[model samples]
Target: MNQDKRQILAQYEKSMTWVESLADVTEEQWRTPIEVGKWSVAEVIGHLIPWDEFVVSKRIPLLFTEDSLPKAPNVQEMNANAANSSRLQSKEETIGKFLNGRHQLIDALHHLTDEQWQHSFHIGESELTLYRYFSGLVEHDWHHFLQIEKVLK
Candidate 1:
C-alpha cells in the first residue's frame, strides 16, 4: 500500500505480463536455449519459481528471526543449483508453478507494512533493503525475459 510496496507490485505486474506473453510460444520455442547458455525458457521459468518461493517462504521468515540475511551465493552457483534441481518441472508445469509463485509473491508484498518494506537484509557483505531486493528481482526478470525473447525470435 505504501510507495515502496506499490513500486514492487507494479514491477511484478510488468514481470507477470512479460512471462504470460510467453504462454503463446510454441513448445519447441520454450525448449530452445536462451543466450544465458544453459537455460531454456522452461528452465528460466523453473528458476524463477524458487526465487519467489525463497523470498516468500524462507528469506522473509529468516529476516524476522535472524539478525541478518544469509550470505548470498554467487550467480553461477545459484544457476548450477537450479540446473541440478530435480524439482524443475516440464514446460507446462513450470509455467503453472511460475504463475502461482508470482501471485504468492505479489500477495505477500501487498501485506507488508511500510516499516517491513524498509527492513534491511545482509547479502554477502552488502546490506540491502527490501526495496533493493525487489528491484533486483525486477532486473533479473527483465534480463532473462530479454534473453528468452531473443531466443524465440
Candidate 2:
C-alpha cells in the first residue's frame, strides 16, 4: 500500500483500539453530552456505525462499477435513530455495534486495489477520489474525537 493508504488503514485500526479503551468509562460519563446541545459520547459513536455500514454495503461495491451509486440515506432520521439507540442501549452494546460496523468497513477497504485508491467516482453529481473520500471521513472522525476528548477532559 502507498503511504496515504497505509495511514488511512492505520487510522481505522487505531480507532478500534481507542474505542475499546473506552470500555472503562463510567456510564454517566458515556451518557453525558459532549456539548451543551450536541450528541453524547455514546450517540457520537453510535452515529458512526450506519455511516460505515453504508460505505461498506452501498458505496464500495459501486465505486469502480458502471452502476450509479445508491442515494444517500435520510440524514436526520438516521442520526436520530442511532442517537436514540445509544440512549437505550448499554455502553458495551453501543461500542460493540460501532466496532462491528467499523470492522466491516475496514475489511472492505483493505480489499480495494491500489489503483482504486486514486480512481474518481460519482456521488450524485460530485466526483471524488477514493483517497479523498476516506480522508474526509477521517477528518469527520477526528472532529468528533476532539469534541468527545474535550468533554472527557
Candidate 3:
C-alpha cells in the first residue's frame, strides 16, 4: 500500500483498538466527568460522531467534486447540538455511533484511488491533502481520548 493508504488504515485501526478497550467500562465510569468543568467520555464521543458523519456523507463526496467547498460550521453550535442530542442517548449508543461513524468514513475513503488520495482541496489561502485532513482527525481523536484516559485512570 501507498503512504496515504497506510496512514489512513493505521489511523482507523488505532481508533478501533481504542474503542475495543472501552468494551468493559461501567456506566458510572462512562458518565463520570473528565474534569471539574469538562465533558464526560460519552459527551466527547458525542462531539466526534457528527464530524465523522459529515466527512462520510458530505465532505469526502464534496472533495471529489468540482464545486466550491462549503463554509465551516460553527464549532460551538455543533458541539452544543451534539451534547444536547446525545444526552438523551445511552453511553452504549454514543460509543456505537463513534464506532459506526469511523467505520463508514474509513470505508468511504478506502474506495479512493491513489490519485484521489493525493487529491488536494484549496480552502481559503491553503491547499490541503487528503492525508493531512484525515491525519488531523486522528489527532482530534487523541485530544478527546486523553481526557477519557486521564479521568478514568
Which has the greatest TM-score?
2
As for candidate 2, its clashing pairs are: none
| Global Cα RMSD, each model | 2.8, 0.9, 1.4
- Cα deviation in Å at residue 123, candidate 1? 3.4
TM-score preference between candidates 1 and 2, better one: 2
Which candidate has the top score in lDDT? 2
Name model 2 segments beyond 4 Å from true: none
lDDT of 1 by residue, 36-99 (tens): 5577777777777777887887676676555666555566777667655513456666677778
Candidate 1 backbone clash number: 0
What's model 1's TM-score?
0.82
Q: Would you estimate the TM-scores of all the predictions?
A: 0.82, 0.96, 0.92
> lDDT tens string, model 2, 1-153?
866678889999988888887788899889989989988999999999889999999999989999988898999999999999999999999999989988998899889988888778889878888888898998998889888888988
Of candidates 3 and 1, the better by TM-score: 3
All candidates in order of lDDT, best leading: 2, 3, 1
Given candidate 3, what's the lDDT at residue 48? 88
- Model 2 RMSD to the real structure? 0.9
lDDT per model vs. reference? 0.76, 0.89, 0.82
